[model samples]
Target: MPLFSNKFCPKKPTPRKVELSVLNKELGPEKALQDLGLEIGPIRLKLGDQESLFDNGEWLPETGPVSGTHKENHKLRQYVQQLEDENNLLKLKYEILLDMLTQTTAESHLQEKQMEQLQKQVLNSSRIPRTKR
Candidate 1:
């Protein structure tokens, strides 16, 4: 009468937890976990009260740029500003190109009218009788 008969139940797989230090080392410290859709918070250990004895002498507390949400917000704001500046520059280029296109179109129409007028003048001159030379 075992709790899990080999035939009835398969063994549950153990869940593996990734350490923040490992992630930081692999992904660089500047990258925010939130960017990858992962939440950041304190790490919890599975051990009981006896785990206190294994604590390391050195404790590195979060501080300065690495400490809070402000850094992430700053990065996001800078990214947005860069995008806005790029958008504005593209818009300016588009306007300049449009103006050039408009000017070219106007010039082309003027040239066509001039050509038509020259053709009409040639036809009129040819139709007029000339003195024999």
Candidate 2:
């Protein structure tokens, strides 16, 4: 607590100052900031006014308008080509699976017909009487 209020005194308030005496003296302010991963620099803030909005900050690409557009177009074309290649591969896989399914169905149907023929041959032989020799 103060002995007397500053309102009655003629002394003015001085600015506050800090000093890291013992443990932090070895690591200075810059080293401490680096250790904490803090950077002290002029940061580019998104301003509401058009003063530096159009100015090339870190967000804007350092390229001409036409070149940037061309680069975007090239990326889109590459993406489209990749998608087309994937579509063709999927179509090829679908055709191969369809052909395999068709072949399996045909083989199953043929096996069913063979089973019916064997059953008929057994029934016909049982109906006939065998002569004693």
Candidate 1 overall lDDT versus native: 0.72
TM-score of 2: 0.50
Q: By how many angstroms RMSD does model 1 differ from the true structure?
A: 17.6
Clashes of 1: 0
lDDT tens per residue, model 1, 1-34? 7776676667899999868787788787667465
Model 1: residues with Cα > 4 Å off, grouped in runs: 1-68
lDDT of each: 0.72, 0.73
Instruction: Show the colliding residue pairs in model 2.
Output: none
Q: Model 2: runs farther than 4 Å from truth?
A: 1-62
Strongest candidate by lDDT: 2
TM-score, cand. 1: 0.48
Query: How do the predictions measure up, each by TM-score?
Result: 0.48, 0.50
